[model samples]
Target chain A: MNGEIAAILAMDGIASGAIYVLIGLGLVLIFAVTRVIFVPFGDIAAFTALSLASLETGGRPGTVGLVAVLAILATAVEATALVRNRALHRLPRALLFYLVLPLVPAAAVWFAAGTTLSMPLRIVLSLALVLPIAPLLDRIVFRPIADASVLLLLTVAVALHFALSGLGLMFFGPEGVRTKPLTDTVFDVAGLIVNGQTLLILAASIAFCGLLFLYFEFTIQGKALRATAVNRIGARLVGIRPTSTGTIAYLLASLLAGISGVLIAPVTTIFYDSGFLLGLKAFVGAIIGAMVSYPVTALGAVMVGLLESYTSFWLSAYKEVLVFGLLIPVLLWRSLSFSGTEEEEAEE
Target chain B: MKNSIVAAVVAASLGIATAAQAEITVGFVTSQSGPGSSIGVLYDRGMKAAVEYASSVGAEKVKLIQLDDGSDPSAATRNARKLVEENKVDLLIGTATAASTSAMVAVANELKVPMIAISPISVAANEAGDRWAIVMPQPPSLMVKIVVDRMKRDGVKQFAYIGFSDAWGDLVYNGAQKPAEADGLKILTNERYARTDTSVTGQVLKMMATKPEAVLLGGSATQGALPPLALAERGYKGPLYGTPALLNTDFIRVGGKAVEGVQVSAGPVIVAEQLPDSHFSKKISMDFRAAYQKANGMPTSDGFSAYSFDAWLVFLDAAKRAMATGAKPGTPEFRVALKNAIFSTKDLVGTHAIYNFKPSDSYGVDDRALVMVRLVGGQWKYAP
Candidate 1:
């Protein structure tokens, strides 16, 4: 290929890789903190995109109904568990977090669904509507099984992906949605043309990565999460609540996924089940990181995006196979390198 | 209301009203909850409209049993078997994707029952030469030939090809080769993408590098919009051509401005109003439209639902002929008679095409079945 074509392909690759980076980072964060694979991470992103599209088109996003249902279920589960543990004193706080917090955004969406809101407000509303899904799912599905084997949690996560996708269909319907671009500006970088949205995605990815680094290095809660990820037993001994750390991880990851969704909505059509494959591709990036290092995961995800773009150009029919096939060699190398190391099991 | 009344009047004039006591059970399996549901829902609504119209017309009583296969082939097979063995359905009609429909075709032959498939399966799978099953949609050979012929008329010497990496894609691509060769046109590249792929920039870039005269897409429904959107982004302004699969409202809506001026080979029913009033399919297409609106409370915008409606029409015709032989419903003799009647059908008009099925034929249409429509300002306009 000529230099121009190669440059264009690289641009496409980096743009898509940026999306994978966000998703990969979220997957790695959730897996480390919660010992849950969080297979439905992409679903959250897709829902966010769908929600944003709904708001843009003056329709009530089905995310409102989904978040409302999940919030109530979470509250019921939390309430029953607390009452059984004789922790009635914590009930009000639980209600505030589990019920009232998510409901505020849902209520906002319900009231503002059909109005011609500004694009920024619509985006914020979409993010707010989707932000609770992952954390509330933690309360409802993962928290009770917190001490279960990592394998079991993984199985449950996979099952939850199917259930959520089915629910995605019920909520969003079958038609795919692609929103208008956030901006119409185009840039010519020495003969390579780049759209404003691509620049936004690249900017967002870099900003989020920098923010994540700063937060981990400088913040108390971030250190707590890091400690929990490093050693759950040691962290517990140091008075770190695993459940609280898990919640924080989920919330942060949900935000990342939501941001990715909003960024991606205009670039591609978002469907109810579209998230699974996208998430799976990001999971490959996480695997390249050995499911821990954030920078390596981001790098790996970008590699995947570049590799996918190149492969599609060279071998269009086998693009998915080639992209997914990279996993085998990475897994083999990881196994060989870490053969004798004793990894901490997720189970208590 | 006016349309349904017209449909009723047409039904009365046709004299298809049969004895209500002789009931025929029809089993319909469709994708109601999975990836295929986008098209499956159309089939579901079409069958519902067909059932409603038949009842209003005082046709033979039909006990319609519908099941959701969830787009799984094994589930479709299980559902088909259950309908035949438990419900004793006289005929079978669906399950949306080609894979599931092929699975049902096997079940139909194995269960010794006649079936109508609403999706296109590979001819190898439909090798049951004795014909216990037949396809409702036009074969890719017939549909793609029109697109190729149009390409020839447009003075295009070569084109790029991009489609889904699946059976449907293979069907369209394979169907295009012979006609393209006959027309002396070259297909420069064959690129494929998954249905759920969020982007096709890589494929589009590859195609653009080849610099073909035009592009032909083998994708359908919402996924079909991907390549066009990518091409438009790259500012590739050559004409686009596709088959009947691209004739859906979601495709136009999703593709938006990028898909404007795309020419697609479609069933006559899609542009029913644009068809001359003397056209054979015009009256039935109008009736089907009215019946669909009355039953579903919305207009039918895709070509898929008409397949189901045509399936019902064929079944109704066959059922009437089968009963004329004095065979009781739910018996093996009745099924055999029904199969024979369906195979011998000649000049039977429906919304999409006039079907003339023979025992050896898997598909039952000719060139008269297709019309070319171009996407103009977000609506499919009759191009010819």
Candidate 2:
């Protein structure tokens, strides 16, 4: 292959790898803080993509309905908590924040769905619908089992993935939908064409990931999350609400997944069950980071993207076999290098 | 829902028991749920329309039973077994995919139930099939020949192939090779991918590096839509070709303008209006097309619907003659009679092709079964 063509292929690989970086950050954050595998990370991303397509078609995204249902359930849970604490006056506040909070954006989406608004506003509204899902699920399902074993949490996460995908099928119908590209400009760079979408993805990934790093380094809540990841009992003993930390981790992770989904939809057709594979690939990248370091995980994910691009060209039929085969050597080397981290089993 | 379905089944059985009548039972096992359901839904609509036509005209009464395989081959086999053993269906119709159809066919032959596959899962009339299985869809060889021939006429000789990593992909790749070699065309690269793959950028780049004259993508339904879109995004400007398995509206709808200028071989029923009046499939195809539109409330239809309609016609014609021999449908004698009748079919016109079956070739459509189509202006225009 010519140097220019190879340069473009590497760029394409980096573009795809950017998505994996977003998803890997989410998986690692959720796993470190909450000890949950976050198996449904990819499913939510796929749903986010479909929601944008639905908005583009002027139909209320199925996620708007999901947000409303989750809002109602969360309100009930908070109401029950208030009654047990004998804080009767706080019921309306709980109801307003939990139930009414979601409705405003959902209602805006409902109104704007069929209108020919600019693409950016519609995408923001689609993200508005998907962003709340992680926090709601963390509260309703994961928080209850917070003190449980990692194996149980992992199994439950897997089950949730299956349930969400089934519900996705029912809501979205059995059709694959593609959205218009955010930008159609193709720049001629060094005699090789570069897609505008690829540049957008790479820029957004770096900006968001950098913001996340700053948030953790400077903010009190970020330190609380870091402390919880380091030692949950220590954080709780220091008056940090471990539950809220878990909820925050979930919210950030979901935001990453949702944004990744909207960015990905234009490049490929999105379906109800397509998320599982994407999520699994991201998990593979996170594993390469030892599921703790953010930068390393993102780096590993980009390598995955480049490896996938080059290998598929060399051996098209064995692309998957080779892609998955990458994890074996990484695991072996990590195991040999970090033999002192045997407390991995005892900590979880 | 399960209770209600069982209640309905029981009530229907009671009604049949009181009437003391033997009804022809035909079981259909297809992917009514899961990723393959879109293709299954179309075949279901078309087959139901055919059944309505026969029932309204007062042909031999048929009791249709269906089971969902969820696009799983093992599930299809289980459903076929249940239909043959528990439901006692004399004839079986199933499966929109080649792999699931093979599973269903194995069960049908083992149970001695006459069967037909509505998709391009070709079943040769061999002793292994026990003369009990046949396919109604156009052969992959016949369909791929049209694309190769159309390309040959346009002075194209070399191509690249990227297909699914399954039976459907293998069929198109192997089938396209037969006519391609005859016309002195070379396939430079052969790539494969799973239907559920999130991207094919790697494969598209490999294809572009080789610089073939054209690329042939063999994906069924909307899954086939992905590769062309990816190829276009990579700025690979060459003619494109596909198989009859991609003859669905979803392919065009999801593929968008990127799929414009794509050429393929499809059943005449897809572009029935464009076919000449002298064409053999024109009249029957027009009738079938009208019925499908009336049933679906949509003007567009594809080879998926036509295959099942042709399967239904063949089944109805055979059931009519089999019933005349005083064979009760729930008996083994009825299945044997039906299989024999299917084998005896000759010159029976269908929406897709003429049904001419023999002991060794049950899927008996010749070159007339397929036509070349080009996607121009987001429409499938007849190219020949």
Best candidate according to lDDT: 1
Quality of candidate 1 docking, DockQ: 0.58
Error (Å) of candidate 1 at residue A21 is 0.6
Position A271, candidate 2: lDDT = 88
**Please, what are the lDDT tens digits per residue for candidate 1 over residues A275-342?**
98889999999999999999999999999999988888899899999999999999999988885445
Quote the B-chain TM-score, candidate 2.
0.83
- For model 1 the local lDDT of residue B223 reads 82
The residue pairs that clash in candidate 2, if any, are: none
lDDT of 1 at A197: 90
Give candidate 1's error at residue A181 in angstroms.
1.1
For candidate 1, give the lDDT of residue B251. Answer: 85
Q: Is model 1 an incorrect, acceptable, medium or high docking prediction?
A: medium
lDDT of 2 by residue, B274-362 (tens): 88898888888887877777777775466777778888888888888888787878789989998888878888888888889876775
Interface RMS for model 1 = 2.0
Please give the lDDT score at residue A164 for candidate 1: 97
What is candidate 1's lDDT per residue for B1-384, written digit by digit as tens?
A: 999999999888655433342578889999997778888998999998898778421355678899999989999999999999988888999969888998998988877899999997743333445769888888888999999999999999999999999887888899899999999999999999888776788899989989989999999887899999899989899999998888777788878899999999989999999999998889999999999999999987568899999999999888888988988778788899988999888999998889999887879998889989999998889988
C-alpha root-mean-square deviation, each candidate = 6.9, 5.2
